[model samples]
Target chain A: MDRIQQIYNDEKLLKKLQEDQNLTIEDVLENEMVINMGPQHPATHGVLRLVLRLDGETVVGIVPELGYLHRGYEKMAENMSHIEFIPHTDRLDYTGTMCNNVGYVLAVEKLAGIEAPKRAQYIRMIVSELSRIAAHMVAIGTFAMDVGAVTMVMWTFREREKVNSIFDRIAGARFTTSYTRIGGVASDIDDQAFAEIKQFLAELEPALVEMDKLLLSNRIFIQRLEGIGILPKEDAIALGVTGPNLRASGVEYDVRRAKPYLFYNEIDFKIPTFSQGDCLARYFQRGDEVRESIKILYQCLDKIPQGEVIANNPKKVLSHKTEIYSKMEELIHDFMIINFGINPPIGDTYLSVENPKGELGFYIVSNGSGQPWKLKIHSPSFCNLQAVSQLCKGAMVSDVVAIIGSLDPVMGEADK
Target chain B: MNTKELIVEKIKEKFGESVEEVSDFRDDLCITIKKDQIVNLGKYLKEDPDLQFIMCKDVTAIDWATRKKRFTTVYHIYSFKLNYALRLKSNIDDNPPTIETVSFVWQSANWYERETWDMYGIKFINHPDLRRMYMPEGFEYHPLRKDFPVLGIPGSLPLPFKAE
Candidate 1:
């Protein structure tokens, strides 16, 4: 011991003394057995690999191995323009592209001190809620499937498609709708786009009711879930759990209410919470949240102020093929904005919106150049992944899947 | 108290020269402290009833290449009630930048500090569970450093595949 102490230092020796004297790093070993929960594991929800140290049924420890799908997205952002970066954000949370787009654009706006037009904010609110519904659909759908309810996934997506169709009408694409611009939306919402969204909402309520009937009261589903994967309120705060997980733990902290941004302040919606922080509580909390999201979407549509989607800045105009063909000046503006995206002032902003998962914030640092010095995506799934290790302890290996599924982690964002 | 000067005044009144909460540590409302004083500052921030900055939102580093102080460790603290943020930065060396872990203040930082350590090589001396967060198995060289390459020779500075 004296010889060992002599080599390191007094501080090292004291630390060694204070630690569980009999224990070593080697003693905290991954020995018993290996259970590789896959890059293709259905419970994982994406290309997520969790290597668990198992003693037969119980997981002794878990080693979360990511980057099977590292797009090198952070490094890629260094080269892309601010506008060009929107589509990439869509891919981050493949479940909810609109929130990703709004969060990112709002961040760029904060640095530039540009405000989205009232109409634009209203439109953004509509699309973001639609995306939230879509995200919750995927979360609840896959979660139900993970715990063995086959039909709900199909029911949720069937309605989700109607929402996607509305998005397709507005932004010319369903999934990666790079809809929100720095100052406003890419363009104004037409009568047709508004009609389609209204139609979708009308149809959406019944689908949600059907989903509740299908999952909420199902005996086996409730049995499998209920008290499983419980995260208490105080522990949830200590672990920095946010979004639905925080709400599930009964904290009632929503970023939209906590720190208002864009049209969130104007819009009225309830923040749903559950006293029980179980997997079932999280599942039901999201179900109720989808109802609240529908309410918000209805409010936005009812009160969407009459105005242009993009602000009056001529420079802000996007080059649509139709516009380019019709007007000579439009051609030049389109190419310039397309080739070189909006250049915000050299500053930084951490603009977060209540994304589908939770607090989806973008921390963008601009160095007086068009390119961002650093683009730190404070993704909700990435933050929530920290809770898995704690949640999985002393539980059966099968329970790990339920716990992970309840969290509803998207590996794309987690790995990003 | 204005959000800008609340932390500065509190730290100045308490620790005096032990810390400097300046508006422009890197041209923001930055609170600069000596490496040794981090634990005390963290504890004070936690127990002090007025500033319930109980949450350590993130722990990261900024590389000022070849400056007198090479790297700065920035700790972001968030209080839901105050609805404001404070950036506490500390200057640490390039060689395995080590600071005492704030696991005592916030348990969330356990994984966060490890992630920072894995990405930027900033060692949290008292981190109870200091293991890799993102990189692959047996990886060496912090990937997030200004100079560290995205690609490193596999198995170069490899620690064993630890499951903690």
Candidate 2:
């Protein structure tokens, strides 16, 4: 009590505190504090823990601790057959299961030297693009909610549910839709599902316009996000940041344009890029990407040719269920495939897809066997999360959530 | 010459003997070079005006359990300038395999190298802060190693302490 009274009575010390209202971080280093942000915190979006060292309210250093949800997917892939791994890919990025399905199947097809039929390729493109739109919706919605705009989540999720219903109609499962196969898709889309997709696309644009009016131009939202967490272009590329985050930092590279897997080369769309490299820029980039994905989806729907959905490679690709039950040849083939997996040739190939999060890749090494010798998943979230420490340093503690939301990391893929 | 031939020729010209194997599979270039030349090659690939392999996409290892060289460390580096990705592999013959770290070259490699070390039990020389990525600090076994079982060894992973 005496010490407190003395300090309170000390005019010089009190004067110094009052005058130096804008104290630099170095001035408060003597009272350095350490805080653990999460392994269970909601702002992290999943099981990600960040150990932050703080000098007053300024974050001096941050170390991200991960792998709370690691199920050893790589080890599991080695044990299972290539065909058996499709369902597992759905769990990698739960928000964009179709994209993960497409990525894994394409990798397997590339490794086995199997070409997907033209119709199947078009189907793959449509579903993956729709999945991309769904993922960006989640990203933008949660991002706005994180920054204190609550209504945007409702608007974004409404559109997402429409996309989910479309998925349910075509893929049978709304969430974990293992819709793609090694040489083709699981099933074909019917006329009703196609009509539903067309209607959803028409509704999405007006809803986006409403969302833009509500959140994008609002003064408080812009002020909260505009210049927060700026990741420069050079640093973004050097740190392996990809997808919307890299594009927001002014990198024009996209896996669809760069590699041209499937019929993406034939499709016309723009890769949205912004030079600001801030939280607002990242948010705007997602909005632009959703628009581009919509464009691609419309083109796919228009140009889709009517043909066989699954490729005719019975040796590598699985036969339809009806054929397996009715035809003797398909039954024998199904039996053989179920017991012994499709054996890819002895070689290694790495195939990446432009997943909404980033470059989701499968590096498969086949030793002329049903099971892969080694499988490495090059997940983009794992790479993007690495740059968090660099971004958060010297920034206010409150902006950490904003930075994480802008990155839009799915912990399933990161922890996988 | 095409991009593939040009890249091979440039790499071979710079380091002749170090370039051990160069092959094309699925239109991708896979180069196996001596472990000693990895850092040098990485620097050259990134710094050269023509080949700006600025992005390090992945760093992983293939565990060949019974081979003479127990592990093969692989790197997939990309050059936006060339619009190509090149795969580089180097063999580590030691038990508890030890190899040079390229995290210094690519900032993104820091976490990837940590992950590689955690999964394969491969020691990366000169790594900044080497620690297990997924498992706890006291966990003994490397889960991704070939000898490690799918279901995991019984009594290996420690369970949480329960109150009486």
Candidate 3:
């Protein structure tokens, strides 16, 4: 039977009834007391609330409340065409938006049934890895600050500035570089960008190595994380956890390895896993992943392929320039492409990509129309969030911050 | 067992007249069963060893605004054993929409079902906790429905104030 116990219209009335109806009887039976952690807390990388039922600091139950940052993304996508949705993807994971942009566009490309050119795929891999590194830096650095290490945040920001400058050189935006277009990319890699990437890679290496030295083996950092918030591998998978959190639990099922998307099949790297599903395992997993990302960047630099960046589908789409200028014939075609979006011949498609968090999937159904008939994003943050309730069942109240930091959920994608 | 063949073969083998599998499932599979048999199908999918479609990935209402009786609750599920996926669609009425819950099968459906109710107003007959997830409690209206104007609340039929 579908248990429809709570109703929105009657929540207060129900709670009020529960308060007075069985208060003498229920309270005599040792009922659990609810405590609200936050809709705004320092440890939750974004705005997240956890309703905990505690028996004197030992968590009896957990209810994760979300949607503080719901920007109406799915509804917003319905109003705009496919191409117009590029900017919206940037808001999913504001920390590492490049990966989010590629994740959405990849789904669009799958529905349209076309592949991005070799050069564009390689460039996407480069930019996405750079974004991955930047995201990990913020996650770990800020997580360190949450536990009382203020020094790591400054170091990470300094390193992140160097990385951001490279993105600024390419797309002229540091924070939200919507560089990924559907077919290929928004633009090409110019001589200036090529030099900046080479230079940044050199400067970024020692910073990561330095971070490893500073944080990983430190007694205080390890004490806060090592045995805190442990989740069993079986429990994590059963809870629908994905991305690094699952890998840190020793799953070893990276989507990059399981289902290689975006030139990932050609690239070589190790998928790191640790048997300990504690906060420290998650912390070091990101560290190992950052090292792996650096390895990917180095490989792409030496053997970058050469070809036209965007797809060669003349009827479907073209570069941004051809759409803006040129003859009226070109203009009409461009207008249809932008206005109508790619009219994917009536079919359903599900495409997922490995983000900094986990498997961020976009399940889309098209009706041979301009807009999507159905769109359901399987946000990894939303799925991984289930483990939190299970993981914190017996932990102290203060450890909730460490548990949240370990999961690293992005509310943009969660509430979207 | 191959998910496509098991779903088709098992349904016909067990309940001959009630099931049929659609072609082109290399990407994902879909099966059509009468709405009345939804509970049976839900139980079978949950219990069967080879086809343990245990996790209910998501549940959302698709509004074909221009079409008649325009409503459907799409169920996405994943089976770790089959290493496969399936989309089960159950039809709902345009007004007073409702569907059977698979919450008993997937405990994770508690909040997901509530969110679907809070968004599209598709009532899950026996959901354990059916309340607004993203939106505030005691608010009357499903925000995700197409007819619920981009900025209007359903009950009051007035502009949805941004701050409130």
Candidate 4:
């Protein structure tokens, strides 16, 4: 009893207890301070305001206020024709515009019962995978930047720029490339564009390896990320989290694997998953996904059969501009499709594509009209963002930025 | 029988008359059930060993202002084990359109329900945080309704120049 009392009353032990007690008192005095972390902030990626209740350095609760970039995309879809809405979808996930375009067109095609040619599907797959690489580059770049590794952003953007240039050659526009049409893509990939894409893929491999050494292998980065913001597998599934965030949580549920629309079934690629479900897992998931996308790009380039890009349906699809000018019948067809729009049968359908961020779904309800009766976009970022509060609970205040970065949400998609 | 028919058969067997209509369009199984039975059906689907639909993919409401049943609340549920998707829809009347909250069954339904309520003015009973998701607070009108003007609520927009 005397020995126990002596140990308790020891000078060093008393000093440590006093220090811990002081921290508790400081926390009690401060109570819960509500701090707003941006509708405008660098780490947020976009206008995402997180009202965080903090007990000292620890996050007690978080209320994520979104819709700052809400452009009324669903409402706008109701008013616009099937073809007219393709461009608007580009803004849904601007970074992954090709995938967004593919997703929207696939939904419209499903509604109209039109099938894009095999070559078109292959071309679409190639472009979509390229877009995935570009999007992931940005995601990883920005994530590393948020964690104070600014040089990674410059390296990633260099590769992303190469992709954008290739996209410009094929699609006319770089970032907001409304490349996809209702029945097919806007244009076919030329030989020059294909060569450029091959070159970009070749260069991206070494850059990715360099990034792994710089960010992934670095001790400081690992220490900051490892086991931080761990989202349990059940919570991730329950909250509708998808893409790398969901994959990081150890769920191998990719839309490509589960419901293979397009030539995803034909393509050989692996869905990378990590059981850690932490910031590090999410980071590594994107890194692995980029590698898989590179594999898909290679397969697409190799296996792409030479054929017509668009479906030949005069009644439903528009003709080429040159053909429209040369022939009166083609002119009328183009005019009719543009002015009146393609009227799909009265029905409702939901179609989703595996976007870089996650499953980007478009639910279209047609009333046998040119325009959709109702259009609902199931944005992955928005669904994934729902799990943020759950992820942030009990995490340190500094870890909030890391968590947000790892989730890789684009506000345009979320708000849309 | 295929997965779609199997799902329909199981659902029909369990609920009997509660299952209103079942349709298979393009291999996509859509089941329309009575509105009151949604929560129970959701629980059963999630818990039942045969049909373990763990994920609620999406929840949305479509406003058919002209129809007797003005709103159709759609729930897309997916089973990881089975690798099948089922779309369950419930029709709600225009007069104070309300439905049971499935948020209790799937945590993802919480935000989806809030968004539905925000856009279509469909009240989700027992939702923990049922508030405007996209639109700001104190915004009264449900914009997605067919009755609402395509541009927006008439005269609600702050025009730079006044109409003559």
**In model 1 chain B, which range of ten residues has the least summed lDDT?**
B20-29
When sorted by DockQ, best at the front, the candidate numbers are 2, 4, 3, 1
**TM-score attained by model 4:** 0.94
Best by lDDT: 2
Per-model i-RMS in Å? 3.5, 0.7, 2.3, 0.8
DockQ of every candidate structure:
0.28, 0.87, 0.35, 0.68
- Comparison by DockQ, 1 against 4, better one: 4
Worst 10 residues of 1 chain A by lDDT: A312-321
lDDT of 4 at A107: 90
Tell me the lDDT of model 1 at A171. Answer: 84
lDDT of 1 by residue, B120-163 (tens): 78888868878877777567666766676546445575566989
Q: How close is candidate 1 to the true structure, as a TM-score?
A: 0.86
- TM, every model: 0.86, 0.95, 0.87, 0.94
Stretches of candidate 1 off by over 4 Å are A1-32, A313-343, B2-5, B18-21, B24-30, B66-68, B148-164
Tens-place lDDT per residue, model 2, B61-109, is 9998889998999999999989999999998887768988999999898
lDDT of 1 by residue, A231-275 (tens): 998788778777999899998889888878776788778888999
Per residue, candidate 2 scores C-alpha lDDT tens digits across A1-416 of: 99878867999888887788688866666788999998998899899999999988899999999999999999999999998999999999999999999999999999999998899999999999999999999999999998899899998999999999999999999999999988999899999999999999999999889999999678988998989999999999899998999999999989999999999999999999999999999999999999999999999999999999998877888999988899999888888777788998889999999999999989999988899999999998898899899999999898999999999999999999
Off by over 4 Å in 2: A1-29
The ten-residue window of minimal lDDT in model 4 chain A covers A20-29
